[model samples]
Target: MQLLGPAQENLTPRGMKARGALAVMGTSVNMQIGRPRLQDLLFSERDQEQGAASIRQLLREIRIALGPHRDAVVTGPGWVGLDGQIVALDMAGRAGADGRRPEFAADLDIADPEFEDWLRDARSHYEDQADDQLAAGIADDGTPALILQAPMSGDLQAAVTAAMILQEAASRVGDVLPLHVVHGDPGIGKISLGIELGALANRSGNDIVILFAARLRSDGRLLWSRRFVLPAEDSAAHLRRVAGGVTVAILHGVEALREVVTDPRLRRMPLQDVFSYSAVRLRRADEQLAQIDPNGDRAVILALRSYIRHTMLLERLAKNPQEEEEMASDMAARARELSPGNPTALGVNAMVAAWKGQSETAFDMARHAIAIDDENPIARLAYSSALTGMGHHREAEAEASAAHMSALSELGPAAWVLRRAIAATRIGDLRSAERYFATTHGYAPENRPALRFLSAIRYELGDEQGAQAALQKLKKLEPDFTLELMASDAYPVDSLRRAGLLKITRSGLI
Candidate 1:
């Protein structure tokens, strides 16, 4: 667990592998794991014999690290375990005496994809555990402060002017935004924004200032960064333009950090726990949010609940569409009421209205959100979905393209590309639709709708093998899915019919 320290550079490749093996074993239940599981975690690319040999060698390296406690590792015919009586795993000791949490096994770099996945999961698990342990210790201030650090080197006067402009621009972007800019070093549980300026002179001796800005989390992890080059002469106009751009980027970072500071419950939950499409997981999040914000005073919490209901409707998680739509509408209304000028709440409301078949309301809400912040990807996506629902394919495709360009997260691209693909299909552009669907699948492989449409589009393009492969994956995710269901009203019947999949399947040609 404590692989990162001053002596990390002294470790050999074998020593690193030994630490990785110990990481896998230490995080497991009771510090015990099956031999096959251990082999898969450490040497998945090797054959059975080679993997077994690697595990044995790794155990020897671990024993050497253990020194006098070499007998702590116990091996059976089919399992490996750490002796509880002799070995004690102190996860908390991995942190500094000042209680700063470091990355788990930060120095252990295994080349296998399986091991990488396990390491990422382990890091997230430990981070959440640390969040829970530290949540109660955070001071309850009236408003969360965002620390703005002065440049390390540059024109001191110009940097101060730039910081002031940035603050003013951020304040004007939203009516009820919850960020207070302060000039100082970052305190615990606060986000820090820093700017750096470098001078670059052209051959003609014209000077330019290269401004680099970065936002860092409480733990010093980077949230966002950007660079801008501005003419040194008459920096007033150029500084304003740069501040406008930086303000938008700052908003993006603040949006990500706001939830963590505002909602203590969210701090302990993984990102996937809130954004998942699984009905069970969504239900759990809904229940937890309700417990914390029972009256729905938190606009972000209400918006998230609305999002969960909207996703349940789209995924067909609920048997009663009418009831689900009503719930989504209620949550969206509450969120809008709480934050009247908030673009995110408006975007969620628009999407819910679109799903409920209220075209006028959806269009109004989506357009209003866009009018507030044109670069808001959620608003753009909501507008595209509304237009697509109203049979305006060309307009929807344009909006979807904008959404994809403005998207800051992985899920945004997946959602917008699916919209673009659907619009392409509606306009009889099968080739473009196929490419968009493939891109969406690349962004989110677990997306069932993307897989379903990919299958239909491939079959239409005479790629039977590819179509069948997609269909097989979809069947694995949804065991009840079939050609019959694809033709029914439950799915996008119009898109399937346009692809000629339904006709071919009914005629037994598929």
Candidate 2:
């Protein structure tokens, strides 16, 4: 891995798609060569034969160039070949008598773009393999890494604001806020900020555990208890065994966030009250700022924030419609008046319309949004969700796939994958569902909705053991899951989506 670090670092985001190949050492009939399991060679028909011939010719040249030492050359994986395989050597030690193994390994500047591309791909492929093993429940030593890290870099203001909020929440006296709701526009970095806060708490000597909310199907009580005592059979019992510690759980997921806010047990816990990157707050602040300077440079930003906040309100109402009457009163006209030309606003408006069961308006708004700015991933994701609500599974999948490929952030990709997985599942495309499910799992292993979807997919795919395993993991995460609770909190209320979910639940070991 150390030998290939430079090549991995050289990979640009666009360069990641280019196929890689090797072209050297193609003269000696006596020498042999080996290659890693690369994607391009595995998939491409022409590259298969060309790659094999190139490697063979390169080995022949190497054997002829080295003279008598040609016998010492051992083919290996990675860049360097050793013992007839690509091997990563401990270069700190002295070189062996056989010159094939270098005494001290020097970093090679792989000038060939193809070779560099191969190295980068191989490095990422192996890294993913390592992560999968870790996720498969590897036993840990007594000393565990306490710091919670975010996958992507976080905003400075978001991080600092989260830290401050957590610190402030710690000083609350009596009848304090149960859960500090970090409300925001979709794809606005609320979860990312939560992760950054968790890391900060970890650094401050707190036991920080971050969980994605989408990974469970139970009530907030069971969900919180489950993560605290994971790997233990009795989740609630383990919570009692560990008496005292400044443990802060930074949960990320809209469903999980909703549950936490409503849970009665929150008052007893030490939760940080963070509202980092909230569109609602931004809108309120903008309203105040307008008083000072009516034509302020931030008017456009304020307008967009208002639209986002309204859209978010509609999303919340979609799940639990208790606030529908209160929110829908003047929100529609306000949303339109705020950002009429913005594609994102139109997409969000579509979602709001769909949630309200206004199919015609939703479909129209979604198409208009896409026509205006097809590259806007957030808008695309919103439109895809709207399509799903209207029972257009195939169309939803296409929109989601496009958004997934174009998404620049960790959360956006995860959201798109989840949308695509659900759409594929509805259309009976189990393979696509399974693939997207895996990608979503990679992004957020503990996401409850994702775990449920994966379990259902595995069951339908005839992998009963895999399905049971997923259920077992879900059980450990949400011990209170039941048919009633699942219907209420797990599946959407849309008739088609609900029926599809019912089939899966009945088929699976749920």
Candidate 3:
């Protein structure tokens, strides 16, 4: 079921390759995935309160698979799939630890007896892995971190790459941004991208929060919600704190954006004026800036920035030309002869540059998007994410948080939380992470990123017992899972820790 592209069956996207030892952690780790179990997991909230055996099995499987891979750079697309695998491996790892302690009760599964049976085995296994010096849980002796991926899909792509959205949302960010939400169709992987970007932001030294708008009540309703807040300007300066947890925002589906940005009172601005008629005129002018060579991605990025912003402005000023940016008729006449630029198509160009890690160029284009229309959330998020990518984390986080707050959209909130949480983890504040996770869980209980992140915090705090329990819980939620797939390179994983953030002593395996 792949797309028809490049005319080669075996050809894969150059960026889509696997290497290193990566770990993926999911949210619930439930069993019997797909349809039937989905019904139980999605609708049977009350029944889930009691726990289920399906989840236990899911955890066991992930453990069995990854328990063998020890230490390596594992990459993958989303944490939901990856967490399923971690739960499995954690179960296997913990089994050995609990085998010795038959009397110690864990914090999870207060009422369930079946979980009790699985707990003994899972705990023992985790203890063994912890001591092995070959796991993400262990001190940096080459053990990889338990990477919990967020969900991913085409529909959610905007949240990951849109520049305008990130900026506007970031502007509203604060020390206690309570919510960050990504609203869109399922399967687009918006949730996954938002969380990952946030984590990346956090790594750069920022505080964040996350909550998903995803609702259990209905499929067509808001699908994701998140909440978070960055530390204030004067947080005692462990490192002269600069940015919010999230620096940018990316969102797709213009219609969805309107739906997600809930507050009518606050301004739901775009990064640029892509929808206004005046923007069309600017876009036509920017078209002249398009590059003829691929020597660098910058040219394309700039061109795209103009397209997105202009298109956004045009959309906003649909009713009248003079009332808006006013580049409409004049630009339209020129466009009639030379044709206007394709904003959406150009925007994709900027994403390509960002993916290649050309943050400077990405930021430039993203800013261009914002310049077109300061109120565009996509441009805001895109610009902020780019800034963070360029190492301007504080600036990016601030931009992302503002967009989320004013836009009142789920994506904005999610971005804010992720950034803040990552910042907390990088600084070794496990307790703070736990608190953030609690908030995000309240919004989207099945969010794999939050669950896996919590697991990492638990491990860092020496809560091996708690970590094992969380992994097992995830197993019950998604059954058809594997650690190998979750850890693949389908997701965004920064290889090798940033130089200053961690002190590393290379072990036998990378």
Candidate 4:
């Protein structure tokens, strides 16, 4: 999802109070960059150490700004760590814990170091040193401290560091021309994280202005959107322009870099996504991957998805996340294209159709997916969805039940059971509904739907008091109950009042 608004013109004084840090995340489907997500990299000892060293260097300069108020920087100056590092949480969450801040945070960096000396439109040139380090961490003495946060959720520290590194790397090109690439995987929140970092840097009053390839709309602008085309051989120059104009250059997508590398005219424009300096292979670098968790399917999916997203990100491919259930279809398609025998690739076509309201297509894919590998969980779920959509009530119930039975406890069973119960209710099989609820109750006692649906079934069978009791429990389970939520969208009319099957004298109907 897009962020709420355009990047603030300034890192406003108000903006300083936030858990502010960019997250660098991308998938590892093809494992190009190696790691599943950039977040994975942040958790590593290597990144933590590098981040700490970089932050310390930045902080040392910042301490100069605070001058005489240095000792008052910390909430309590006398506290010490086990070895005298001085613990912030020593006051018990009052000051800090590792990097958790009770207040806000700010940051600064020369987005590109190589271009640091490049002259902008005017005589002024960007300095390689950071310009806005003063706002990083505020001192308790009314001065600011350089607050270096640890890598928490979303791999925030890595994101900031990546921007820093990327900027420096761009400068090394020495071309002093247009072009820069901001490549990464999909849904790893790359766009947002990049936006945050660029915005954070710019807000610190860095002179850098992101040059968009096109003018940004109001909404796009809020996303810190910028557009530009890099010269075939002018990759470094363009970056220098953006960096020289401002303290940092903000590149939005990988395509930005692709232009420079693939340019036919440039002699030094990277012939490939690589740069060689000493032991470093900067371009076309294989991402270092994290260890996989055999128990997590989503993790596996993410690992795969990252690669696909990265391809698109770097290739400048278009995407539509809201085209209704297209993710599975896209995944299935890619799985076949990339690794057909993987078993997970079989039923993609059907899943896509089903998501688009094509029951028949959904059913067909589901069957095909199962025929290829009945034991496949994703395939089974896809098949069950198709069956339900096609009104194969009995088959849907059986298949969903089978899915539940086949799944591991580590993968909770309630969602599958709920699908089956919905099918039973749709078919008006009162007995079937009763059985489904019974099974659900035993397996998941806390399942609210089991009690509520059982109540509805009892009412259908003419057990007035039993129905009344179920409704009361239902009320406890759902204080603001309505027939609409309890039923499917296929109901003939808007409310239960229109249904010939049930009678409700008051309240909203399904």
Candidate 5:
């Protein structure tokens, strides 16, 4: 199972094929594979008789490699399997001490197309397995823990309602934020924070007030306390409305705690550091994260690095696009490897993939991320970008709208609105495109691309003065951007052409 060392170069064609066959079987179901399948994978270039003969010869070579443990390769009537009881695969060794999974069969240079196909799939399979193992090995490493205190009253209905409210609020806050909410008693060692909920009746007794209080568990320092009044006969809709207000308060409290808390685990400074627009800050954040967790097994940290690289590419901060793309790709791949069930990591991976122009990969990753967390604005934005790239303009617009609506921050909505505007233009909805572009510009007035598209859309819509104003703003931000540059094959020329701006410019409309 471990076939990636320097000695692999000494492997003869037969020895290489033998190791390849073992790799195929090892990654298959129950460590077993059908003989016909193995032959097809390893010797598809040969005729049936030649392929069967090659499989037999390869098996014999494997037996010789095994020596005294030759019987570990158990051959049935039409299938080959490894005896799990006798031959234990050291998956950890295959993963390496540093936890990076080496390329499967890296030394095998078989010319058969079928074998190459199988090798690619086998590599992906083992890579996921290695990622899971490595992720499991990573400790919590001082992650802050939140414990929900039980209600003092014996009224189960009130407790359930209060818990539902807290849960709904937390969902609104989303997992993209670095906050861990755990439901447990104080006995759970060193709980960083504690939340308690209680219900009180209004003086008129026609309404109930739900009190939410959070405090530091370490020294019982009060952090946040608020009360939400609900109707005595509150409906599900009403409760959700209350939860929305509560979500804002909770976020504000969390931000305040992050600002004052000195504990690295409580503050989550690395994650906070990544939100800045400066490349220097992002690089420093990445270095600090690596120092905090040297193993590089934290999927979120890797995903953040990928996000940083992609952001650098977008902001024109990266001096070399090719190098930034490679770094983003590597960080995304590693993050996806270590993140089995995490939607944020998957969303970041999807965003990076879309930025790299791997439309199909971006579509799949974004879909999986959305399936895991439909409300994730990043995932939705990524999906919209992929759809737009594939010319599914209407679908892209819908997803982009959803992303914009659900986005918590101005940046998220700005990106989503820009995509929506682009998709609208592709679909020939000029008015909607203009509106979306204006919204994007409003969110980030310094956004040069939004300004460019907004100007183009207004001009196409015959709003010459409006277009001129937008163009003036764009010129202020990017002096090189002009009607001549827009007509040329420079950045976003295709987009301008799609908006009919290039044609208008050629018509002497300025």
Candidate 6:
């Protein structure tokens, strides 16, 4: 994954709007910052207006811009939440107690000692309320008043306050540059939140530019495509050149940009930090894959097959959302078609099928994959999972053993360990199941199956607290999950395994 950078003067604005903002010195300015996506600019100012004419124009322009993808574009602003609920912020500032626009007393000074205390109290109140609602798995209709920065306007009071804090710092000490560092676990929408904060700063009359490192060309221009290319120089050089303005650079994968933090020149740059973790899931599989191969270029498929397989493993852990499945299917098909008879692609197919409960299809594909590459660890794991799901515990155990014997020094796939645990559980070897479940959890701590099986095994072994701890993680990861959800699925359909699951359910493992 690469960082995405800002587009310089490559294309003309398809359109422009005159935005008015009050300047810091009490004067008015007519100016606007460029949005990363050109299309978002079309409707960026709608919330501040009160006429149907603008909305109608937005629709007409969208029709022209989308040409072939209009239906998907015209869909409402709502997004699917982690719980599969349609969620959209109330952008009109027209609902709930928190909907009221935040205000500061006219006499308050930025240097006042009480200012920090007041800001902390206010932020804590809002954040705690949002946290409570999330923890309780509250329905969308019943959720507490929350403060999410509007995607269009980026006018959340918190974001505004954050910008003010930066401005104060910049003024207090010369060259105390305002660099905000927003970091989070993989799929928690860090980029969007950072952009929103950047938008707030721009609207506050700061010359802020948002860019993605992944899009930066060798000549320091941003390429307006999904393709990623390594920069000719470190991204910090590009940032230093834009020293006159505030810059919000989106780093798609933090690891890929380690130089920014490790290199002496960049490491010394002053930065305000923001980190968030949902304690739920990894980043979205599509976003992750896009970072890996955003443009779908055909030439590097085989060269990147290992990375693709690693992403595929993440897809399985993420429950294989439709977009992920479609992307995986297309990539898997290409991997196979481009390199026919390759064991890796066949193994990937079998794994995908196994996740979708296509047991027989998975079994057949795994057999074919293994026949072509018996020593391939992925094929061995796929065969093991398929065999377990098909009620061949003995055969599955043998396959898992083979995979273990040939496994790399690094931990093998969690799915492989999971299959072994399932076989052990089925064969009434609870001790062995417990050990493998522990290994599975070590390999993929957030994996639901590993957590679930570990919980059940702990309960059976009389480690009630350990079981409860695992269950709590499950609760946080999948709030609506119940023990009944584990009943005799195609993945583990043996009568013995079904009984074991039923007993675990009765034991209140959920």
Q: TM-score of each candidate?
A: 0.57, 0.37, 0.30, 0.31, 0.59, 0.40
On residues 1-510, what C-alpha lDDT tens digit does candidate 5 reach at each position? 343212222222256677778777766778899999999988888899998998898888877766666777898989998876665443432223232334656667777899888778867876766534433311155434445544333344555667677776676454544455655342312333323222232322655557776654433455667777766565354676666556656555655664555555443435434655456776787776565457877676677777878777765567788898898888878878887666767877877877766778888888898887665555666778778767788998887776566524333456777888888888999898899889888876766677777777787788888888887887776656667777775455465675466554553444
Q: Over the stretch 235-328, how does candidate 6's per-residue lDDT look in tens digits?
A: 2333322211222222122222323223222221111110011122123323332343445543223213322433434424325556665666
| Predicted candidate 1 versus true structure: per-residue lDDT over 4-76, tens digit per residue | 2122222223566788888888778988999999899889999999999999998888777666566778987
Worst 10-residue lDDT window, candidate 4: 17-26
The digit string of per-residue lDDT tens for model 2 on 1-510 reads 121112212111111112121211111122233353332332233366775555555455544544544553455554323332331222121112221222111233444555556456645654454323323211121111111222111434333333333333222110111222332111111121111122221112223321221112111122322122222223233231221111222222321343444433222121111111233443454343344334433223332333444433422312334454334323434545555765655665666676667887888887887787565444576688778777888898887876666422233356668888888887888888878887877775545566677776677678888777777776765667654554564344343245354444565365
Candidates' C-alpha lDDT? 0.65, 0.42, 0.35, 0.37, 0.65, 0.42
Clashes, model 3 = 180
Q: Per-residue lDDT for 149 in model 3?
A: 25
* Candidate 3 ranges beyond 4 A from true positions: 1-352, 410-412, 423-434, 473-491, 495-510
lDDT of 3 by residue, 139-187 (tens): 1111111112232322222223222223333333310121233322122
lDDT of 4 by residue, 140-230 (tens): 1221011111112233333343244345433322111122223321211111111112322221122232222211110122222333333
Sequence-dependent TM-score of model 5: 0.59
Instruction: Give me the displacement of residue 469 in model 2, in angstroms.
Output: 4.0
Off by over 4 Å in 2: 1-321, 324-333, 407-411, 472-480, 487-510
In model 3, what lDDT does residue 420 have? Answer: 50
- Model 3 CA lDDT for position 346: 24
What total of clashing residue pairs does each candidate reach?
Answer: 0, 25, 180, 45, 0, 10
